[model samples]
Target: MTGPEHLSGTDRVAEVIKDIDADIIINIQGDEPMIDPAIVNQLIDTFEDGYVEMATVASTVIDNFDYVNPNSVKVMIDGNGFASAFRRETKDFEIGGYYRHVGMYGYRKEILLQFTKLDQTKNEATFNLEQLRAWTMEFQ
Candidate 1:
């Protein structure tokens, strides 16, 4: 894989994944120094199905107002467990109901490769979300 130019740590990570051979790659946020081994195991378990292109965990949101804050991005999953969309605010919200998107992500090798080649979209650039670039190409 070629070296990244002016890429953030997350983008550089996608570049490194291009040359790996593993079926699934788990990206753990380094900032969470106190993460439990059990949580790591659970993350790996979530991707047991070979077809899962990507997977991540989410904890129930205790605050409804936080769900509308742009700093606190929200994610919704499809029936198949794939991420359907991510945004700051979502409609049809009941009080005390939300799911905070965890920073961890598991991805298949091919999907990771494809992710590195996609162009950034308007929403992606505007929101400064690298994940949107991959999902724009249906890679996520």
Candidate 2:
């Protein structure tokens, strides 16, 4: 069983994994069972770099999305292939910079533990995106 105090799935994962021995914790949403195993394997491979403490999957969105809609969260990846932001709102609805943010996450064990204990950020509460807390806290 997990604690009721868990505000997010990641929090629950942290609770379940605290005493377990593992190098990586893949936090995939219960609803996302269809996530591609190949992509997950690739993401896990990125951890071999040692500097990557956390990572999330993202894919190019071919369909036009309503940027104002909270459901279509976009991942801002810089030219160098690093995520700079995750947001539901953007003024640049015309041009580009819209990569669909996949919910799957890979977190190092220690980082996951530290993440669960931190307080939520304003942007996180506003957008209901817990990853915002990680971004704002300088987790990079």
Candidate 3:
């Protein structure tokens, strides 16, 4: 299915989910060994209202260097606490309220299936963030 092997994480996810059956799926990164159970519970609770399609956790950034570091993924949250944007670069106005995006994600089963089929957007490719592909498609 590929000459150059450009399957991104989302693409691989699409491939893996073909056989799974579930109502809700939570994706927690393998590297996050100390992920809080409370955060996972909070993300799961968001689905109980039945309005959220996709959700992720973001932590308050305590260090200035992490806020400006390209390795840290910063998220802009809306007035309602939903994510507005995800980026490696921080905006000028975000210095005070910036939240660093945690790698975990919760997705409705159908939405997760649909996400795998989406084409990678330019912003996603540039940032190397598969989540942006979902954001670009307005999945939430």
Candidate 4:
């Protein structure tokens, strides 16, 4: 199940499981060698509500440098706990609620496939944040 080189981690998982039957799919970035198991549990717990189709985690940015670094993606979560936006620039920190985007996600199988089928959105291409594509789809 090979995907395009430009496909993001979430997109790749969708492609990989196109043939497999599954209720849920979890995507943990390969770069995160020390991902905590508890985070996975938390993601699973989010699904217990039964209405969640997609989810991810975020933590407060402890280092100012990391917060400002364009390499460390920042996330803006809505009051409902769904991600509202993602950005790599620091200029918007003044808007306040900024958190380091954890490079992990859990998706309902159908939602994952739908995510991959959606076209890249303007913000997504601008920030190189694939999750933004799902954001545009109103998955939040």
Lowest-lDDT window of 10 residues in candidate 2?
A: 61-70
| Clash count of each predicted structure | 0, 0, 0, 0
Candidate 2 structure, TM-score to reference? 0.90
Stronger candidate by lDDT (1 vs 3): 3
RMSD of 3: 2.6
Candidate 2 ranges beyond 4 A from true positions: 66-68, 93-95
TM-score leader: 2
Q: State candidate 3's TM-score.
A: 0.88
Q: How accurate locally, in lDDT, is each candidate?
A: 0.67, 0.83, 0.79, 0.81
Clashing pairs in 4: none
Clashing pairs in 2: none
Worst lDDT 10-window in candidate 3? 1-10
True lDDT of residue 70, candidate 4: 88
| Cα lDDT tens digits for candidate 2, 64-119 | 65465778677888886778888777766534876788889999999999998999
Off by over 4 Å in 3: 1-6
Model 1 ranges off by over 4 Å: 1-8, 18-21, 90-97
Assess the local accuracy of residue 135 in candidate 2 as a C-alpha lDDT between 0 and 100: 82
Q: Is candidate 1 or candidate 3 better by TM-score?
A: 3
Candidate 4: lDDT of 83? 77
Instruction: Output the lDDT of residue 140, model 1.
Output: 41
- Writing each residue's lDDT as its tens digit, candidate 3 over 1-140 gives 32345447545554566678877778887667789899899989989978899888999854788777998888888998878888788878777667888888888888887887667789988889888888888877
Q: Which scores better on TM-score, 1 or 4?
A: 4
